[model samples]
Target chain A: MAVRAVVRRSFYQDSMVLMSVAARLRGQPGVREAAALMGTPANHALLAAAGLASPEVKGAAPGDLVLVVDAESEAAAAAALEAAGAMLEERSRASGVLRRPRTLEAALAARPDANLAVISVPGAYAALEARTALRGGLHVFLFSDNVSLADEVELKRLAAARGLLCMGPDCGTAYLGGIGLGFANVVPRGRIGCVAASGTGLQAVVSQLAALGEGISHGIGVGGRDLSAEVGGTMTTLALAALARDPRTEAIVVISKPPSAAALPALESAIRATGKPVVVCCLGAASSGAPGTWVSTLDDAADAAAALLRGVSWSPRAFSDPDSVRARLAALGPARGTIRGLYTGGTLAHEARLLLEPLLGATGHRILDLGADEFTVGRPHPMLDPDARAAQVREAARDRDVGVVLLDVVLGRGTHPNPAGVVARAVRDARETAARAGRGLLAVASVVGTDADPQGRRHQVEELRAAGVEVLPSNAQAARFVALALRPELALALLGPR
Target chain B: MTLDAGLDQPLRVVNVGLELFAEQIEAQGAAVDRVDWRPPAGGPDIASLLARLED
Candidate 1:
């Protein structure tokens, strides 16, 4: 009687016996448990026939256990099994011919002219992929976010060494060599080049420039957190130097939402040394005695950049006259109480404080950075996170020291779906709480984005205004108005030209 | 039955098991040959042999 023999081998030891038979027996259907133990040719031939084993599997010896399985039949089952194994091997080899190649080797073989690799992998895997692409001698357009600062620095260093471009780890937007990569605005190519810290702000400036028939040589987005206290403005410095050197860029625009004082001096020095005409728009604040050009609002920044590109010097203009706001506040009534500013953007809150501190004598009013933990408690990006605003409205409304409450609502894609609802609810709650406390609440608010419906952000602005919150067009203007309400004296200071 | 015919030309054994068997045969200085076997092509009975191998 014919009998079936089944063999099993573990990878721990007896490695040699497994090699010979592994290839042939690996994918064959007839083979059950095939392993080599000690030195045995029994499984080696089986593996070789199945093509399951690697080239290294051929040298397996006896006294090492290799596994093999054979189905017994009245006829020669081994030959039939071997034929089946060969057919399977033929199919596998043919399958490769039938399928399109997806490996790097295949891509290079197909398109030898492909010089750039645009990577949009997950953040954690970005560095690895970037390193691989660099090793492969391809320019990288990295579009991943949440990459650590150290990784970015190291990657930038590697890219510089390789003489290749490393766009971003969290770089949401960029226009590279006239190609729009990632989430970039379609702006014409012109003599002006821009490097912005904020993504949406960059979009706004680029769109506005395009509208004015001005173009950009390049608009590099140095991830939002680059200019913050922690990162120390590393990418900004690099971008400034690059834009400065580019011959196509007759004028350069460096935009950020204000950097820490320590970061400013270094950046200022770099800009002054660039010798190229520079328009610096630190969104919510004026440059602190820096010599380069300055603009306060995003719209004005775009205007300045367009004018500079067209060989014209555009002076900074106020979005809304601070005096008008002060006059309006005075007309409302006599000095009521302390002013309160609850702002989404940290830079906006800082700007409001700068405007109010001198006028309110620093102690008369409060400026809260809703994005700050001390104010919002465990909330991130205050405009997107509703819980923070919910708590803030109640606190501001209940405080007897607070009479005027100023809010800055930032609206954009990747933000809350209904920012209007958020603002409306917060306003209603605060108003009710203040009314119950028998205090009059003067609520002034501002919308950050445009009417282009950037994720229906315009609706939020309309809702806030409809709900009786005095809405301004820009954060800078809103913060200025908030400051004037806090201190009538600062209004006069702003009215005087510097 | 001609059982002994072509038996001396080195038995062409195929180990269609898992990675362990592949590793073992690879170490023995013999090349492994792998083939893809599916149901529609009518291959040998693997489950019964596997059960026997376990036993």
Candidate 2:
């Protein structure tokens, strides 16, 4: 086998495009491993970790484009490299057919009255583009991650000062006027609005609300760190104010990874100032001493918000069908062991961890957000493609200590069309793997989407259930089910708060 | 309407990166302008420097 590296000076393609090129080459005959990347230090390290970095590759500059190919023969490596060059050229030609604007400025100039700019550039350039959009008086939905906290604070403050919304530096989901944006679910338009610091958290809430015969006014994501002490809930507060003014919005839901104690008062103040009933679903947030109706699970967030809209008293919900879920787990007859959670949404993973750890203790469970940076260094997020999570499912099943595997299949635009299928096959493989080892594995999961979603919610659930996976009604229910299964003595008490 | 575009006015989107996202927006029947984003020829380090200058 031969491993070779080639560098092209001053050639930069979109990182997503390069990653796709890498993925395509990996599928080619005789190719064992490949990566197409700009020679950033991080990329260099990633390539090196993959054993694709030759000594010549070690000296590459950030300005250079690098392709490292590992193949069955020297000739194969050269051929693959040539193929990579050809693909780039073809993509470049296809890009010209549209004659798209090369800069945000150029696009905005053409649509001077454009109100929103969805900035999804690489993190290094995202802030600059976002700044330009905000300066041009557009509400910014910034999708790029790795933006510094200082930049986030500045941009959000600037947006707030101008009476505009700056959604995220790492925000992945939002909906405006029934229009889904950046990994959003297609839910109907209604009076419930959302301000979330977690992407799947918002999806779970809105989709649940939709399923409950409620719809959304808007769902805004304020990046993950907005509620950190440093950023101090800048965009969260602004989004609340906007929702408050929004005529269609009767209530709001605020979701986040529990805000820092230092940031809570600011968040609470914003919730109060809205002067509207709000569903406060800060997953894993400490005891509710704040204003507005607070709920623990994303499921209850929807139930409470819809109830508020209906003029009915809101109550916390346990599981949709506790008896059936319990029976399913009992039938699995697994040993009481640790939980292994493989998740696509960071928020959903955080929710699952919080729900289980308090009872089971944190040490017994291993929860992972597959879309997290560690899993996506040189690959697509599991949301865009399900292979990473699928591979992890098989690996996690091999552990005798893992009793329950918690999974979430979040369906939306721009995500894999058949995430549920990939997960089903993975779970089936996991079950077979565990059975061969004379161990048992129980997989519990939830679908976070409405029936209108392209990958229909019911269809996804049926797929998992067909594979012997007990798919629950909501994320919180799935997490709680695992807890109940592990500690059957806890019983219905596990269904409710301890 | 001026402060919150989605309140009544149609959402006018300028998708600034990732061509696929633009296509999805368009597929949803929303009016969107695609920004064919390319990094600075010098790559991310140069992009960072350019960002600082833009700031």
Candidate 3:
């Protein structure tokens, strides 16, 4: 007679409750199994009880009470059960039980102010979750990466019909309402808002802005691969439009790591139409000019953003000026036949290609996208994926054509076993191999993340630089430096005539 | 029963029942806060009560 009345809700409605219950039941002694069902559908209850057929007992409705009991002492158990039941009844009467929200109708009835729905289910189930969220009149933040482009397009279209913001299918970082969502920095609230096509790049700017004592109204990360030739800038366009109308935002900072040329014009035009001041930071771009300000480095982007936030007017500095760059390049000694561009992020490779492509021309084929499918293979992140690319760097050092090998080392939370160790070993091995080949190999690299990262970016960059690889603040800067070393003439044009 | 003198320390009590608990505890010269509670399948247990009490 010791009755246990378990209240169940839909996974969509009461996930925390369901998960907590499952966890508790796993530890409980008397409870052999526990299942949370959406409804008292014969199939659902049967599935919950390990597919055992339920007896012809009364079935419970949505918020109805059902008691199940198994106790040795019937009288005591019944009395205890009744007491528990009475307590539950009293609690229910005092504060009504929330019915399991089945349809979009039910979900909306519960959380009317819920503007955004974040779907984090498996890839196959993501589309349904998104559809449900959209139908519930919620803006969908699709956290599920690797969703097909077709599915994304449909979801985006649906979101537009309801006049809602559909953030991303693989959107990693966002700062909404002065709160960090996903991998984001906690900058204070200010007039400057961002809609970036990169996560770490966006984070760098946000952190730097915070350091400068400037706040951010919002930092919307529009995924790294958004501006590629294939995807175009669907979300970027919508985000720009929304931020333009946002009263909190007085200025906008658009950041990207050198998107394809085809994608640039449309994005540029959108910014121009916004009328609000914009600070553009397309990493690896030699020069950029809009109706607003242009910045080169990630640090410069943050500085520009902070200045904008403070309503302080500022102009862009020419970091990639040719003559200045050539002077610096010429000042350095003879060609260290081998140089390593060690980078943490993937875009560093694309940035390196831009800088080196002009100098090395076609021979820049040595540029390896470490995070690319070919290199990383089954691994998660290129920098986090150990030994495979590290070994490649070792081999590259032995190649006679390989004069300078660039390494991009990105530091952030959740990056595998300290990146310093990986780069340190790679640099050590590469330098050793280059020396044996009777060629000097200079390891020129950059640390992508900031002090906000627990791995200690400053220390890691120092470690790599101390190990003989030149460490720059960003992957793009490192690539620029490598390009300067390779073709001093191009460097002269970029920095100004020496 | 007499109140535990140790309860003189700053304490936070979370009640799952309703605001009535808050009123009752306050009547007893103790502080209790009411919060939304959606207990799992097995319903409210000792651990949950402890968690609520801690909250």
Best by TM-score: 2
lDDT of each residue in A1-498, candidate 2, tens digit only: 989888887665665787778887787779988878878778888887787778788877765789888899998888888888888879878778348777788888899988889887767778888888998998888888877888899999888888788989888998877788888888888999999998889988888888898888888889999999999998888888889989999999999888898889988898989999988888876546799888888888889988888899866757687667667757766447788999999989988888787778877689989877666654566788788789989998888898788999999887789899999999999999999998888888999987788898899999999998888888888888787777776675854432
Write down the worst ten-residue block by lDDT for model 3 chain A: A8-17
RMSD of each: 22.1, 2.7, 15.7
What candidate 1 gets wrong by more than 4 Å, as runs, is: A1-149, A163-192, A200-218, A224-234, A241-250, A257-276, A282-291, A295-300, A310-313, A319-327, A334-340, A364-387, A455-459, A495-498, B1-55
Q: Candidate 2: misplaced stretches above 4 Å?
A: A8-10, A55-64, A286-289, A495-498, B1-6, B41-55
The per-model lDDT (C-alpha) reads: 0.57, 0.83, 0.56
Q: Residue by residue across A10-60, what tens digits does model 1's lDDT show?
A: 221212122334445545554444433332344466566675355445554
After superposition, which runs of candidate 3 have C-alpha atoms over 4 Å from their true positions?
A: A1-129, A137-145, A185-189, A207-213, A224-232, A257-273, A282-300, A303-332, A336-344, A372-378, A383-389, A414-417, A488-498, B1-55
**Candidate 1 residue-wise lDDT at A328:** 67
Q: How many backbone clashes does candidate 3 have?
A: 31
DockQ of 3: 0.02
Q: Which of candidates 1 and 2 reaches a greater lDDT?
A: 2
* Chain A TM-score of each candidate structure, as shown: 0.59, 0.93, 0.64
